[model samples]
Target: MFVQEIAPLAGSLGLSALVAVLPLATVLVLLGVVRMKAHHAALLGLLVALVVAIAVYGMPIGQAISSGFQGAAFGLFPIMWIVVNALWIYRITVRTGHFDVLRRSFGKVSDDPRMQALLIAFCFGALMEALAGFGAPVAISSVMLVALGFTPVRAAVVSLVANTAPVAFGAMGTPVVTLAQVSGIPLNTVSAIVGRQTPILAVFVPLLLVIIVDGRRGVRETWQPALVCGLTFGVVQFAASNFVSAQLADIGAALAGAAALVLMPATRKPAREEVRAAVLTGVATEQLERPEDRGEVLRAYLPYLLIIVIFSIGQIPPVKKLLDAATWNFHWPGLHVAGSSGKPVSGNTFSLPFLNTGGTLVLIAGILTVLALHVSARDAVREWGATIHELRFAILTVAGVLALAYVMNLSGQTTTIGYLIAGAGAGLAFLSPLLGWFGVAVSGSDTSANALFGALQVTAAHQAGLSAELLASSNSSGGVLGKMISPQNLSIACAAAMLPGEEGTLLRKVLPWSLGLLLLMCLIVVGQSTILSGMLP
Candidate 1:
């Protein structure tokens, strides 16, 4: 039987931890500094992890390889599965011209540009994150802002900042799901903890967006709607994630935030010169006409509504039990490994959630959406194919990243780092979020960061006498802030804003926001671990 040892190099935890960091370091340096392609960097990191697992950690070579395969399977099945179907659902909307209808509806929310930032950047961006994360929200929202007459740099910057609040629940809750899967925590527990943490940011991001869009003048005049949107989003996100389904958290918050704006007190429009200054393209914000028919707006919104309704119904006890009955659970072959307790580690087993998996639920939602939207069967198939094609490289990166994670984890590399970091005792609570933030900054994905460090957070939390759920959820909450600074995201946002080769400018603009928010999240997590413990679920 293969066994894991926290410190296998001269029995020194520090030295082993130092060695264990190589695979992660390899991935980060290549992505962040070398600017290597993501898939290539991920594969190289997997190679480093395998070498460390077998040579440094003394793991069995066969089991190491087997462990990597197991992780790749999980990545492909549930993680990427959820992302693909969610994107497919979005593509179906795009293919049928409903997305433009929805876009115009948002663009016409208010004549003032500040309200548009709240609606499009904060609210609609959250909806995009919920459906097709991994930088799609930043790209789409930034481009939409430019289309609506905002400066390209401002569009990219505010979109990056506003995209932070919903990231923990992005891509149909894949990031939190990955955190739960890797940490051995229950999905609901992770979701509930994250729901509490990120919503705090939700209450502030709308305000930040208004300030960015129009400076002090924007806030002075538009703070009412910003407060209403942010407050509604925060409350609904908290309620839905805790009491309702985590998968529907962002969707609920997005719709609620938008509704709050629609029902809010009216505000005066910006001056023409102000619009011209922001737009620079000479396009007037009020020129884009809203759809005249309320019926069309209802149709544009039905797919998201259908998702919430269907997923919520699936959460009913009887239906949940029936759906879960089809899941397959089995121990993985060629992956027998013992933890510190001298018992087989349970993570070596794999679960196939079948009808209960997020992918399946989203598939059900997509089918309903196709019917309601009147998308032809042929076009639906085409959208699915287009989604697979678009996500091909992303699929490779995710699978490789997961393989790297499992190799590091199963061979004790992560445990070594965990034990080392746990040496900080209570201080680990304050430092935990930085680990996730740094990971995401380099890797450009909250899901990837969670996969790499979720188990480590749990291990460190146990050793540091902190709550595993707190640190685990803190990882994601902190990582959301890092999304703005990720090189990949900067590139995507710049390209979308038509600010090609201006990534440096965009990076400088958003870096402070990312760091400032990260500090806030760090403080929040520290408090949650101590005096603010009541905040947790």
Candidate 2:
């Protein structure tokens, strides 16, 4: 068994932390500053992590290789699987031309660019995040924004930014569940704590998206809708997570946000210049003028409605239990790694939840979408093939970064860095969230981030006399902001936006928001540990 060592480099915590960070730093700087293609950066980052694990951390080569493959398998099967099928649903709509009609329906609601963004990126994106997270919201929402006439890059940025508000409870509260399990906190307590935390982000993210999409002019014209959307989302999420169920939190918030916007005073149509820009972008801008036929409108909306209905049914306790039974679990071959306490890491055992995953559920939705949209079976098959082909590099990028994360994690590189940060003691209240942010920035998964550091957060909190449950739950809250800049997410958004090689551009654009919000979460955590103790469950 390979035992983790938190201070392996010459038995020095500070020195080990610096060396431990090289692989992650290599990834971020190469992807963000050097403007490297995401797959290339990710693979190179994996290579660096491999060397660090063996040379510095003393992880055996056999277990190291096995761990890398295990992570790569996890990424491709359940994670990217969700994205592929979700995009296929989008492509099926495109095949029927219903996607354009859906776009026009948004124009019918409010052709104001700002309002369109509020609906698609924030409201709709939150709904998607609720049902099927693991990159599904980014992939589908970014493409929907493009169809709504936002620039490709802007759509990507908007989708990435909009994703943060609902993520702590994403995938039916997977991240929070993972955190509670790892941290030894009660699920309700962790859920309640994160419920209080992420809603704060929910209140501000819509305003931030407006600022990103339209600057001051957009905010000036549409701040009312943005604020309404954000407020409703935040309020509903808080209620659902604390009072109802964390699994239903984002679903409730998203539906409420959408309803609030629809009920708001209608805004004006897109301006002449906006129409011209849409035309230049090949948007068939004239369709906005078409009088909506009732049946056509229903057909235009059928696919998404179908997705909601199917996912909701799948979430029923009995149905979910059945699906859960179909999953398989096994220890990864030739890999055994224990933490400093000599317990085996849960991550080293792989669970293949083929039936329970959102990916399979999305596939069911795609099949139904094919029938509802009247898409030919032949065409649907072709689109699925095309989806796989289109996301080849994105698939590689996801797998590579996940492998890098696993290599770092199983080898102790990640814990070394976590220990260095946790060493901050009472200042840990101020710095607690960074461990999660760093984990997510590396793995592109808040769920994975919690799995990596949730227990560590609780352990550190105990040592520092802080609230263990609060700090543990805060790991997930802080990790949400990192989603925008995660290399895997960057690749997924770029792929869906059809800006395949622009991951670096997208990273540079979203990095400021990610860091800025992470700082805000840090302060919130510190306050919760002291003055804001009433906020805790």
Top lDDT hit: 1
How accurate locally is residue 41 in candidate 1, as Cα lDDT from 0 to 100?
98
Please provide, for model 1 over 1-537, each residue's C-alpha lDDT reduced to its tens digit, 9 standing for 90 to 100.
887898899989989999999999999989988999999999999999999999998998899999999989988988889888888988887787777777777766666777777888888899889877888899888877877777788889989999899999998888998899888899899999998889989888988888787888778877888888999999999998898877889989998998888787653354466654653442434346644577777887888777777778888999999999999999998989999778888777999999887788888989998998888899898899999999999999999999999998889899889888898999888888898999899889999999999999999999888898999989998999899989889999988888889989988988888888888899999899889899987
- List, residue by residue over 1-537, the lDDT tens digit for candidate 2: 889998887889899989988987887788667878878987998899999999999999998899899878866877678768877777777777787777677656776667777888888788778766778889877877777667788889989999898988886676786676546588789888888888888888888987887788667867887888899999999988887666678888998998998788844544457543542352423357778778878987776677667767776899989999999998889988998899998767787887877678778878987887778889999999998997798789778877877788788887777566666778988777887888787667787677656766765676667788888888899999889988779988999988979988999999999999999999999899888899887
Least accurate stretch of 10 residues (summed lDDT) in model 1? 278-287
Where in model 1 is the C-alpha error above 4 Å?
A: 267-287, 290-295
Q: Pick the candidate with the highest TM-score.
A: 1
TM-score of each: 0.96, 0.81
Model 2 residue 476 distance off true place after TM-score fit, in angstroms: 4.4
lDDT of each: 0.87, 0.80
Q: List the residue pairs that clash in candidate 2.
A: none
